[model samples]
Structures are given as structure tokens and as C-alpha cells.
Target: MRNRKTGFILVEALIVVACLVALMAMLAANQHSSMRETQDRLRQKRAESAARSAVAYVFSTLTSATPNSVTLNDNWAQLGGNGNQSFELGDLTFRVQIIDANSRLNVNVATAPQLQSLLVDQTMVDSLLDWRETSTTPRANGAKDEYYTGLETPYIAKLASLTTLEELLLIKGWTAQKLFTVQTDVIQSAITQTDTNNRQLPLIDYLTVDGGAPNTRANGSTKINLGVRGVTLNQIVQLGLTQAQATQVFNRIPFNSFQQLLGVPGLTPIAQQRLLDAVTFTAGNRVTGKINLNTAPSWVLQTIPNVTLDIANTIVTQQSTGFTGLSQLATLNGVSPTTLPRIADSFVVGSDTWIVRAYGKSGEIGTAIEATVVLTNGKLQIQKWDRLNTIGIPAWWNWEEEPTSTTAVGTGQ
Candidate 1:
């Protein structure tokens, strides 16, 4: 009887031991799952915080002063030549870029000739035009509703301004692969010639449709008037001209319109184009779409009428200190008064719209955000905002290798 009782007790003990072991295993699994969830939540919070901080910092810088004053202060230089700047905040590291929208071609506003010069694809350019125009009639190489209706997932043509960059993917013959190939080729060629440190300049970098309506404030107010009585030498200097050229401009002042600046003594057609690219001369405090002379690449400068490659190169080389006025461009080697008028009205000393991209990372988890904002009448308004899966790091980052302390935390811009 005593042996039987001992056996039963032993069996019970074993059974209890097995149950405790199973419970321990289950608890351990639960703990691991909980830990993973916690880590993911922490990473997501960090990413959101980092993105908001970046936007706040950029907007503050943009609105700190007048648009031209911000450029004159050289604040945009903080973003670096390739538009990539990295910095650290708390436990998160961030890579940020601020792109002047005016530095890019406007799909809605660029002429056919200008689009041809930039895209080098007549058919694509024609398609782009057809997509935006209200008419159903196709251009020489463009597609219409009929072409779209034939697709596997048939849809009608947009016949309106593009609301988003992704809309390009829907255009006929604009495959994702083709678009990527073209953009990659263009960026590769540009970096090779310009030594842009192997930075990747995506297609979106060269194009935009946002900058607000030309000559109209975001608030619908009229632009500050520009004329002899309203204009000052200081304002003329903002045209990228030198003090001497500004003085000359002042002498030529009391002018009636922006067109009159083309006739300034010794102002070359190229210089005038540079001025046009950098300033707005119409009445009312309107913020027109104008390129920033301080930031535009030689290729972008070439988009101006009568601005040859050699002339563009001269402008780029002489822009070390950046242009405070359009007259400063006249000091370039080949720029004479004869060529300035042709390019006037294409540029502005300040930027009203900017594309800000920020990347945040913590350990293996990372997130990125891209935003387009416009500054008008001292107010900052966000036009577009999106989160990205990849941060688009440069080739030099060697992402295949293990991240280092500096790379993981990011270096200041």
C-alpha cells in the first residue's frame, strides 16, 4: 500500500513539472512578442517626431525673413550643394534636403520648347501636353482617350493639370521602368559632369507643378507694385547685380516695367535673362514662379532663352558668393548687355516654394518624409506631404556595409 501511494505521488509530481514547463514556454513567447511590439511602437513614434521637427525647422527658416532676405542670408546653403544634409536629434538621426521649387521645371507652365530641352523625348513631352490640355486632339506624338481606353485597365485621359507626380505613371508609354531609366541616366550624366558627389537626383528633383499662381499671393492679395517710385536700388540689387551694376540700375531706375530693365546700359542678353530668372517686377506683392539664381544648376540656367552652355558655365563658376542682384551676372566673362534681355523674367533672387525631404533612423528601423511647402506674405503653407519607405541615401553611404556611429547618427548639414 505504501509503495502504491509513493508511485502515485511521483506521477503527480511529474505531471505538475510538465505543466509548469509548458506555462513557462508560453510566457516566454508572449514576452518576446510584447517586446517586439514595444520596439516597433517606439521606432514609429521616433520617426513621426523626427519628421515633424524637420518640417518645423525648415518652415521657420523659410519664414524668418522675406524670401529674398533668406537667400541673401545664405541659409539655403545649409542644405548643401546636392541638397542633402544630415543631423542628429535625441536618439534619432535625420537626413534632410531642401529643394527650391523654382529651380525645377514646371510641368504646367513650361513651354513645349522648354520641355523638349529638358526631357529630350518629343513623344513624352507631347503626351504631357496632351494630358494637360482640355482639347482631346492629340499632338504629333501624343495619346488621347482612345489610346488610354485600349489599355488592360482602360481609363480616360486626364486633360487637366497633374495633381500628383504619380500621375505620370498613368500616361501612355510612361512605364515605371522607362521613367526610372531616363531619370537615372540624366542624373548619372549630370553627376559625372558636375561632380555632384554621386548624389542621386531623381526625376522629381527636376520637375514640379506647385508654386502657387503667378503674380498672385497665396492669400489672394495683389503683389507689391514694381516701378520707379516703388522700386529701390536695393530691390535692383536683388536681381543678382553687383553694387556697381546696381548703381547703374539705379540710374536706369524710375523705369516703368520689368521690360525696361532689359535696356539697362551694358546689360547683356544673358545677364538680362539671369535677372529675369531671379526677379519679379510686376505690380502687387505677387510671388511668381522664378528660379533661384543662387541654387540653379548650369543646366537649369541653360533653360533661359539665349543662355548657351558656355554662358551657363560662366554663371555657375562665378556664383561662389552667390548673386545678390541680377547685375552681378553682368560681371561674367561672356555676359554683355546685348544678351541680358533675352533671359530676363526667368529668375528670382528668392524662392517661394521648397521641397523638403527628411529621413529618420533608429537602429534597423527607419522612416522618411517628403514635403512641398510655399511661403507667401510671410506665411508657410504645406502643399504636399508624404512618407517614404526608403531614405534614398547616396552611393557613398555604402549602405551594404554595417552602419557606423557617425553614419547611424548622421552628421550635421
Candidate 2:
């Protein structure tokens, strides 16, 4: 009874309450930590599942669309689910630029009006023309000789090859930013020659892109001729073919009917290989009279008669829910009666189509994982991935971080 009375003292009671509060706090802290860990693991698992689901969509739907190749050159429909709900895991809303890798450049194969219709800035077209002209010292419009000569490095000694698209920064009036705007759909890599010494050497044996056009020019002006010099071929005839030589030479025949070339016997192993490696054929415009609206990218849609990016993205988003035809897009949020006709002639929905997916996890710093799939050639091939920079990603995967944008972006968009 005495001890109990002592324990019931006001100070002791307050101490007991304080101890209880601290113990409770410690237990709560441990529970919170456990909860957070569980939530994080769930988030990670969900993200990974989303990625797999996205990949599955590409493999199934996109691959079935085409047997030849997958293209990332145009519009991408919504990949999975719809509405605010569509914005869930594996919910991919983005634009893909789908075109035959071998398709002729709209700017090059196009008539002047058609080139204008292709909907790129007039200035970009002008610069392209300037570069295509047979001028050694081609100065882009609005740029002077000093500007070309004033490069941090000397302008390429001669335009033996196209400088990468990124090199266009050296062009007058083209900033790095402007290049990004114009070249998003385009791929840039060195079109390296196997042998620079031989004029008719076999060129890019590994020409990528769908519909690999033979001798297609990067500028849509010049053509690559991967062949033996006619003169070299003639010289091969002067040397009598040993039996082994004849077999090796015959193996490298360029023409299916070599009966005509049989009279000339001098084809060397190298020359014969060149003939076999070369592709002289050209690719016609598969996109022809129709502009498949469903497949066109937002940029391509913007090029449509009067649609802006907002309207274009809107049209693209709406088309995901099974766009039967271009006309059906009139029901979209921003579509007006007047804009309908213009869009109709410009876009085609639900024809030859592919899907591009961009989904990733976000952390305090920024985007953690991102993937890009080009649904072409009837398979979902990863065009690029930017998460972690390598292995898990490819070099071309692009991630756009939340803009630190204090100022609004320009009208150029």
C-alpha cells in the first residue's frame, strides 16, 4: 500500500506518461518506416509491371500491323487503356513518326508546293536546298562567308559526306535548339564509306530504316552508288579468271542475268563484291496520296493544314479509342466544325499504324526509367531507352525532365 501510494505521486505519474509517450512514438516510427518500405517496393513492382505490359502491347498489336519494318518517324496512338484511367501504369500516350526508312524525303521527292505541304519551316527547306546545290562553299541563307569561316573548327574540308545532323549547328542561323526542333524525326549518324579510295566502292551495307532505298541521298539530292567503277570492272575483264576466280566472281554477280556481263571477264573479287553489296533500287513513296492520320506523329499533324500541336495531340489522344477513320476525330475535345474538313484531307486514322510508349518512374530528382519502342516489322523493337544511360537503355532514348521553365516556351513550338 505504501509503495502504491509512492507510485501514485504526481511527478511519478507524469514520468510514467512521458515514458509511455516515448515508447509509443518509437513504435509509430518503426511502423512508418516499414510502411514506407512496403510502399516503395510496391511502386517499384508496379513500374516494372507497367514496362512489361507496354512491351507486350508493342510485340502484339504493333508487330501485327506491318511485316517489313518498324518506323519511329510519325504518330503513335495511345498504347493501353483510356481516359484519366488510361493514364495508369503501361498507359502510354505519345507520338511516333512512322515512315519507311527507305521512303523518299518529302522535301526531296516533293514538288515545291508539296515540299511546302510537308510543313517544315521555309527557312529549313531553303538551307537544305543551299546544301544540296553543287556549291563547294555553300553559305546558308542569312549566313555569310565569315560566319562559315568563323566556326570554332574549320568547316569540313569538303562535303565528301554529310556532317551529322548535329553538325548543322555550324550552319548559319541554326542554333542547337533549332536543330532539335527540325531533326527530331530524323536519325543522324556517319554515312561512312567502307573504302573512300574507290569511287564505286560498296557503300553502307548496313543501311538501316525500313524500305532501304538503294542509293538514296541523305539530302534527298545525291544518291549513293555502291558499285565497282565501270572502268575497274572493265579492267577485271583483262585478267583471265582462274576457275576459283570465276566461282568467286560469279558469287558476287550484281545482276540476276549475268549473261550480258559474261563477255567481260575481269571482275576482281573486290569489284564483284562491290557489285553484290550495292543497292541501286529506289523506294517509291508508300505514303502516296493518303496521309494516314492515325499513323502521323503530332509534328506531322501540326503540319496538317491548320492544326496546332495542342489540337494535334488532342486528335492523336482521341484516336486511341479505336479511330475508325479520320472523320471520326471530329468528336475530339478541341475539334470544331470548320477544322474538320482540313483535318480530314490531311490525316488518316486506323490504317497502317504503330505504337510508341514512354513510361517511367519519377523520384525527387527526376525521371528514373524510360523506354521507347518502335512497333515495326511486326515486332516491338526498342528504339532506345534513357534510363541509367546504358545497357538498360540505348543511346537514342530521350527523356524530357520537368521544365525548370520560369519563362514560357516560345511560339516556335
The most accurate candidate by TM-score is: 1
- Segments of candidate 1 deviating more than 4 angstroms: 1-34, 69-73, 79-85, 178-195, 198-200, 212-284, 328-331, 336-338, 391-413
For candidate 1, lDDT tens digit of each residue in 73-111?
356546422334445677776666676776666777677
Q: Which ten residues in a row have the lowest lDDT in candidate 2?
A: 200-209
Q: In candidate 2, what are the lDDT values of residues 1-413, reduced to their tens digit?
A: 98878868977889999999999999999999999888777765555555445445445445554322123322222232210112223332221122332212222222333334442355544454454344555434433344456777755322322323334445454464443332333223212112122221111111111222112221223322213323233333333445555454444544322223322356543433333222222234223223444334454455445566688677557544434433355557676644543444333222232223334342321122334444333445665443333332222323222221221112111
Q: Rate the local accuracy (lDDT) of all candidates.
A: 0.63, 0.38
> What TM-score goes with each of the models?
0.70, 0.34
Residue 286's lDDT within candidate 1 is: 44
TM match of model 2 to true structure: 0.34
TM-score, structure 1 vs. true? 0.70
Best candidate (score: lDDT): 1
